[model samples]
Target chain A: MSITRITVLSGGMGGARFLQGLLHGIAAGTVPGVSPGAEVTVVANTADDLWMHGLKICPDLDTVMYTLGDGIDLDRGWGRRDETWSVKAELAAYGVEPTWFGLGDRDIATHVVRTQMLDAGYPLSAVTEALCRRWQPGVRLLPMSDDRVETHVAIADEAAPSGRRVVHFQEYWVRLRAEVPAESVIVVGLDASSPAPGVLEAIAEADLVVLPPSNPVVSVGTILGVPGVREALRTTAAPVVGLSPVVGGSHVRGMAHQMLTSIGVEVSAAAVGLHYGDRATTSEGVLDAWLVDERDADQVDRVRGAGLACAAVPLMMSDVDATAAMAAAAVALVTDRGSVDGAR
Target chain B: MSITRITVLSGGMGGARFLQGLLHGIAAGTVPGVSPGAEVTVVANTADDLWMHGLKICPDLDTVMYTLGDGIDLDRGWGRRDETWSVKAELAAYGVEPTWFGLGDRDIATHVVRTQMLDAGYPLSAVTEALCRRWQPGVRLLPMSDDRVETHVAIADEAAPSGRRVVHFQEYWVRLRAEVPAESVIVVGLDASSPAPGVLEAIAEADLVVLPPSNPVVSVGTILGVPGVREALRTTAAPVVGLSPVVGGSHVRGMAHQMLTSIGVEVSAAAVGLHYGDRATTSEGVLDAWLVDERDADQVDRVRGAGLACAAVPLMMSDVDATAAMAAAAVALVTDRGSVDGAR
Candidate 1:
């Protein structure tokens, strides 16, 4: 079966990097059963969105757009390539709060445009579409939901009356560096947020769906927490597959290990796959197959025992070619499983 | 008489340059009969204020602040000295409107702070005061009024249905370059605006009031149009003096000639002085003494005949020292005229 339409659930840096490789593999006709001309749709997590200095910032959406559009700062893995920080420095000089989050000058233009449109009553999805007109990020990028969904993390605080305090995910991740132990992950407004326009439709109409190696707890997990999003994934006719963010019991980049730990999920490749679960057995399951790294081959059977078709390949995305090979392996894994008869 | 508390009604570039010299002259003790430690208060014209790209831009206020705070671009005579145009370039690439107004990265920081404060329910005066905490622009800079006041110019547009078009002051000045013939000047909200906090008290308690070499019609005239502001000036106990922005047969800089023509005033030093009129004769007059330029020395007698003390001096603001000499000349002209007891 040839897949011409593919949908991917994404986060920031990790998801953006994975999409680049996937697109490269498809263009090179190396992703086993996928068409070279496949139309990719990205439903990105908005839980990491923030408002700073009165401007709305969508970190993940901008990451994907800038990365694919060749405007990303390659060294930093974010922001504009040749960005200036005059505005950020000036804001700090003014002694405003949250000076830790650096907003680049070139990036501020995007936020100004978005804030203006959002203030003028355009939804986040529409604003994203309008912004995409400039970046033309190759894929159809839609926010997970139009309503505000912020990820808040509860961390133990010795001085607090309750012995714990909740902080915005950006405060925890960007400011605090996610070093402190988090008591729980609280996704405010996620359960109440409806899927943004075209989100559910993209999933239901896709030939296949792939979950990139984004942060499972706050990224892909937050998207699934949106009302009707998990149900759409569970019932979609297309086969669903995912590559492990974890390899040898730890994430390669980002604070995914810390986030998973906060949500009480084990920091292991097999545990992450099992956490997503198998679509054939449970109503909550969404993935048809799970791909792990070669170093974690020992845990492949443990994931397979949960009724998910599992395989181990070289999942290290060192470069484009290497990541493309990982994408190819992921596609071949699902193709080799030979279609779960009654699941679809 | 040692005049200590000096109040000046000002506009943008010309006014800002004049204030620099006035302060310099006061510090150097070059101005005749003026205290070395005199406190200067600037009542800036807010009629040229504009809202662009969802940011409130007060051109005159920012010009005065940047110039006084040493952040101004000396070459351009406005904006920050080492400004970058990344945000402006990106905004142009985004294809948003009003691309004519170039907002630099450093300058946008000021607008961002101001916009954020204004959106949070603070009035323009309070926002300006808060911003001055950073700039510390020596003088107590106050907008003429806290109310929204915009200067609109009616230009003869043959293509318009009514054979004319009314454009914002910035559109006329910046975009159109103020080359076209202006039919009239209309100040929206000026009539309804009350003087900003401390504005009336500054005028009433001032030891001397100086109208700098700014655009007489749009800048000083707009402030005078604010109901109680003119009354305060007319009834103040201090001597009121003004320097001619016009020299010879035209204005030294800016589109003052075109603005004067729009209001049916002749573009000559003598006419501008007479337009302000002598405070001793008419209830409408606000000037106790008017100083014309040396180039227009022949017109000095014409102004003196209008029952006001008038003199001729070099009015060109070639540099700080030259402008300081001009400020001293203005101060000496008023001192030589002697006091008009009943008028004060």
Candidate 2:
């Protein structure tokens, strides 16, 4: 029996939670157990990392990292648990510029080491590797790019000092609370930065690709910005599966509704499925199967009409066990497809 | 009737400790009770700042800042008092490089913000200014230069692969415990870096200049490496005074004896006095007056023979009050000189 390697493209909290469930499911021997154990690869988004007070902060990557490595602050949804703030207070006393962002003391040690390594000319992947040695995130976590690519939002603030401010994703989410209307979203440095080492290979060789209930526009979308990433997904023989972040016209977490509206996509699972339509479905891109919640069963044919395999199931990942069940369902769908292909 | 401005050329621990006493003495009305208060400008060494655990740790400046701002760790001799080590434990768990240097959770915050600001394009001087605003050390403290000048010690290693090695100052001090005999020391990056803002004016206008009892080979030597700093000290008309760091043949703190030996200077007040010599005393280099401990009173003629106005006082700053008394004596020497110059 050959190993079935599962590849996941993830963002922050939601994706991390789902991956946790997937890992749990694998451990419980539920999700189509593969011989020689299952290999998991997480291609993470670095778009959310912003330089605040001179430290590189990647919210999404760290979330997935801490969650998988068992170092995450589950209560805060970001940073490490049992963190301190001595350095923050000291910095505050210095009246250092850009004092808005709060860096915890324990959290600061990580940033200090990361910044130090970066200054010493280590790439983000190598630094990530060095950091992950302790967390052992259970899977190989790769940043979309070793180079910097910050996500920026263009706001129509005609009255402001800068007619349009290009704020980093973190400033939009963490500082501004996503209150300002985004006229356009831009991922800076995408044109220059290539995908990290082994990223495309992992995606290409995976038995199945999973896009855990992450924000399609920023989370998965930013990962797609990496050169060769989306192309690998489109051309891979493996079936691609995505769990909808939208449930009952609302996001599970974060201000995904505003982001969806900014990109002209409706805040619905059907719209989300259509947004990532089958290459054959709407001449948009590639997506083999689209899964929605049981509540949105009425939108099943609409999803099928988009020219892809569609399924409506209990998609609420209520707990670790439930999340594994969701992952199991997706795996079952891909396995069923594999058998059909084998017969052909 | 007018406020007198005092400028001091400082090294690290001893210099900073002396400043602490100077402040205390002035506060207690021990130093010529002038109205509108006295202003002090401290030109500090950048040589001791090392890139440890990937942080630009300026031991001297931070010592002065913490000491004056009332945050100095009383027992540790470096870093803030009451700092936690949870971050250090975590960093160690990750098997981070340079594990020997202890960066407390509280201290790590300072490094994080400093690294961040440095990445964002602010010069070290501006960064120091911002840092001092919080510490409010009550003195205008400035780095000798905005340039990167790392002190590297050339060591003759016999037990290993290479017979000779250039180790960073911290590696030599903290890691190797300075037991390894040093061949020579190099202040890297000093050739291009300029003296920080306000350094020259402070020296030119100063009524008195004092070289605090810091390490002559590295701490003060590094400051002199900045192109114009030594020249400014050389041409200043104010009487220059220095308290000897080497007392009765032993360093009060640190491995100054080892450093002095490496630099080919004997660990004695007489050798340090002659090292500064008449060039620092007669017309322009550093001073007209030199203060040695009462134990070295026999060397008064020896110092005077080198063309410096010499005085032998009980120079042991054993306590805060004693330190203040020492500072008062330095001021009295300067005042007497100024009065004599006025008569001329």
Candidate 3:
């Protein structure tokens, strides 16, 4: 099928980067069979969201919005561009807890607007839509779920403050730097959450589904954990292709190795591709094709042997052009081998 | 009586300035008989407080805290010193309403901390106290009432779709600049709101109670409008004395004239004194004495003619010493003639 409608299951930084390249590709008419008029829908993971100091903060959704809208702090790769730290400093001075997270002043404006809307009886999905009227991220951006779903990391605590502390994902990643081993990744409230408005519909109506090299466990993985999402992928007539976040034996960025280890998944491209499995082999499985970096070429045959069309390409998104090339490769991989007949 | 506990029913700017000078007087041992260790307990008006963008902003309470803690913007006489306006600008950029309030970046920190605590099931008074632990305002600061009480102004709207407009006190004062004629000053929920913890107790145990030269109608007047507060003042053994915010037939600062005019009280020093009324004459009266500025000294006798001892003093609070001198004159006004016999 000619690429027209594309849906991406996304996380924060890595997912945002891929979407940027994909948008660039669409705009430049360079993303394989995809044209400039192609509509992209991003279903961002809200499992990474947390309420801090009474403000609802959606790191993944904001990342996709700010990054795509050209408002992201380029250096930080998460918060707003030209952000100030006055609010954060004042918060620290007041000795409010969880001071490790750097909440930029410019970023806080988004939170204030969001929190106000939420308090006024608007759900998270509606709030995101209202906020997007400003950012104009181009693509239809929808949160994974309107219900509160927080990713908590279980870690061994020798201090025994609570025997073993299950910290919020941010505290684990930002504060602890994911240095300590995580026993498990707990996605609280995700199992009970229904897909947010337009989420399942976006997936169902899409020509293709792309999983950019986001954290398989926390980012894209948690998004899949939401009920009806994985089911939509299984039931959709469109092809589903994924680019491996795991390059060679580790993540290009972030602590995917730590998270994968915690979740009892192997830290390799082939292992991750197999973990997603083949739609032909398992009725519950969703992947039709998987792309890995050139360095992981040796694992391509192994990934293919598991009943999914697998390809090795240069997947480092150094810039928009390079990332667009990766996106193009992803589109070509799915189009060539993940066509309607290729499902067999 | 050795003045140990001093309670002041205060508004924002004017009350804050008066308290600053009062503290200075106490520190210098110059307020008639008040010593260095004199403890001040301020009952601040919560009527001016509003929930903006999901944050509880206590203008008067914050004014007292910021002023006493030396964090206030001296030039603006409100908000934190050396403040940035990034949040305010961002809010405006997002097209959030009532952007005229000028919430400083540093000042927004106060609101955030307050909002967080309030969301976490703490009362406004507790949140204020928790926030004060940082500023160390050196006085017991109590919100006039823990309950929500908003001062809304009724305005004539000849051109309105509804033919009338009722705005929050901030909307009237900050946005409108109180330029439009206020039809009535309505203290919503005031009659239903009981005094906050330590409010009535602070009044009952005080050697002296002061009505700082804040906006008498909206600020101090609103605090007295709280259910138990006015009754506490009427029954307390402490001499209840007030200083005139009006000078030279006009307010020294702020919109006292407009609010007084809205409530049908004359916008003059003597009229304000009589408006509080003679404590001995009426069962509901609350003020034992009133002081006018030197500019309105001629009206002092007219105030005394209303069955209360009155005095004229320099009230411009131009500097700490001048303000301390004014505070001294106020203390002396109540101590000398507003003693037990003065009530009779």
Candidate 4:
């Protein structure tokens, strides 16, 4: 298949990194089935979106935009490269709440513009498109939903605090550092929200869909939790493949371990593949193939047994070439399976 | 009579500067008939308020806070000292509107805080009090009204590409530099606006009332334009005095000349004094006395002929001592007149 249109279901750091490498591969004509002229569309999770000091901030969308636009701070792996914290400092001096979140001075421009557009009756999807005009992140980025959908982490609160025990995903990840055991992840407002404009269309028309090494539970999970997105992934004619965020026994990076533990999934690559299930046989499942790290080659048989086409590859996205190689491996796995199915 | 509570109707830069000098004079006990520990309440003009980049910015309110809190940039006469412009630069890069407004990185915090509070169901007056907890701007700062009241300038625009030829006050002052002829000043929504919670009460309870050398057509004018504010000034038992913003044939500073001409009033000290009218005699007028600069001393007889107790003093606010002397001259004029009334 000539994969001229590629769709990526993404999170923040991990997804942004993978998309960067995938873009580099396409530019180098190295990602299998994907031509250098391929058009990429990113369906970003907005469950992590927050309203701070009256500005709407979408962490995942901004991370992807900044990273791909070459404006990201390489050291911090997020936010603007030469960002200042003058606004942050002043906000603190004023003793405003939720000072823990990182809102850099340069990054604040994105929020200000987005918030202004939102206030002027533009949908979140259109606002995101307007923002990308400046970043030119090389892909069409659409938010998961125009309506609010926040991920809340329900944690055991022995301290008897005044507010609800279930805190915002940001308070869990950024403030608490996910120290306490999470009871469960609650995808608030997801049950009522329809997908944002062009989200399901991108999924249905894609040459192939790939789930990058993002948190399957929160990042990808929250996107899937939106009513029509998961259904689109399951019913689309295009093949679907996922790269394991879990390498050997841990996530490549981020809170995947804590999230998986909360959802009662084992902390292994095979377990993650099985958690997604197989798209070919399972009635409502959404995975066609799964890629694991080379060190987790032992899990390939276990993953295959779960009715998924499985491949083991070096999956650490340390650099563009290495991550592109991993992207190439995932494409090869799904395409090879397609060929075998055709022959059968 | 002891001047225990003083209320001042003020604009942004000039009014704030005058308030600072007044506070200094009160603290030094240089102003006669006033004690060192007097409570000051400032009724600030809100007509210059603008919703730019989706944040509600009150230029006058912030100027008062920044100046009195010792956080203002002395050279610029407004905004936070040691401010950065990273947000402004980034916004310009994004091509957002109102690129001319100088929203410094540090100053953006105040807007952000105020906007958030306004969004969260708090009135502007309440929000100001909450902000005052941080800056401690000394005097009680009450917005002219809780309801929205924007000042619009109708200017000659035979070449306007969009909308009415009328523009916002900021646009007229900053963008057009007031070079074009202004037809009239419109205080939109002022008729429907009630004074913010403490505004009328401040005037009614004040031991003395002074109108600082602020723009009479917009700053002080707009506040008086609010439905109940003008009535309060007319009925208050406290002696009302005003310092002429117009120094010689032109304004001491700001766009008072253009504004005066817009309303068909002569741009002179005596003209401005008569425009306020004589509160002691005129049944509905709002000023009992008016002060002119030593340079405009020649117009003292002209002002007295208009039924106001006229005084000539050096009105140059060269420094704290000079400005405090101005404040002293203003208070002495009102108190001396009050003693004559008492003897009668």
lDDT of 1 by residue, B132-204 (tens): 9998988999999989999999999889999999999999989998899889999999888899999999999
Q: Per-residue lDDT for A328 in model 4?
A: 81
lDDT by residue for model 2 over B1-344, one digit each (tens)?
A: 23377788887678888998888887788865333378888999988787666667787888888888888897776788889887787677767766888677667667766766786788888878878877899999998887788899999977658788888887898899888788889778888888888898898888777887888888887887788877787888766778888778877675888899987888888778777656554443456667777777777778778887666667777777888877776666555545322221
Q: Rank by DockQ, highest first.
A: 1, 4, 3, 2
The residue-by-residue lDDT of candidate 4 on A1-344, one tens digit each, is 78999999999999999999899999999887788999999999999998888889999999999999899998988899989999999999998888999999999999999998998899999999988999999999999899999999998877767434998999999999888888899988999999999999999999899999899998998898899888899999988999999987988786668899999999899988888889778876789898888889888889889898887878899998998887888787777655422221
TM-score (second chain) of model 1: 0.96
Compose the digit string of candidate 3's lDDT tens values, residues B262-336.
Answer: 989998999988999988997778998888887787887787787887887777989999998888888888786
Score candidate 3 by TM-score against the native.
0.96
TM-score of model 2 vs. true structure = 0.89
> Which residue window of length 10 is worst by lDDT in model 3 chain B?
B335-344
lDDT (tens digit, per residue) of candidate 3 on A1-344: 57789999999999999999999999999887887899999999888888888888999999999999899989889898888899999989999887998798888999999999998999999999999998899999999999988999999998978768899999999999999999999999988999999999998999999988999899988889899999998888888999999997988886779999997899999888887777778866779889988898888889888888888878899999999988888888877654422322
Off by over 4 Å in 3: A161-163, A337-344, B337-344
- Model 4: which residue pairs collide? none
**Candidate 2 DockQ category?**
medium
The DockQ-based CAPRI class assigned to model 3 is medium
TM-score of chain A of 4: 0.96
The TM-score measured for candidate 4 stands at: 0.96
Per-residue lDDT for A117-213 in model 2, tens only? 8878998988888888878888888888898998888877777897887777777777787888887889899878899998999888988788889
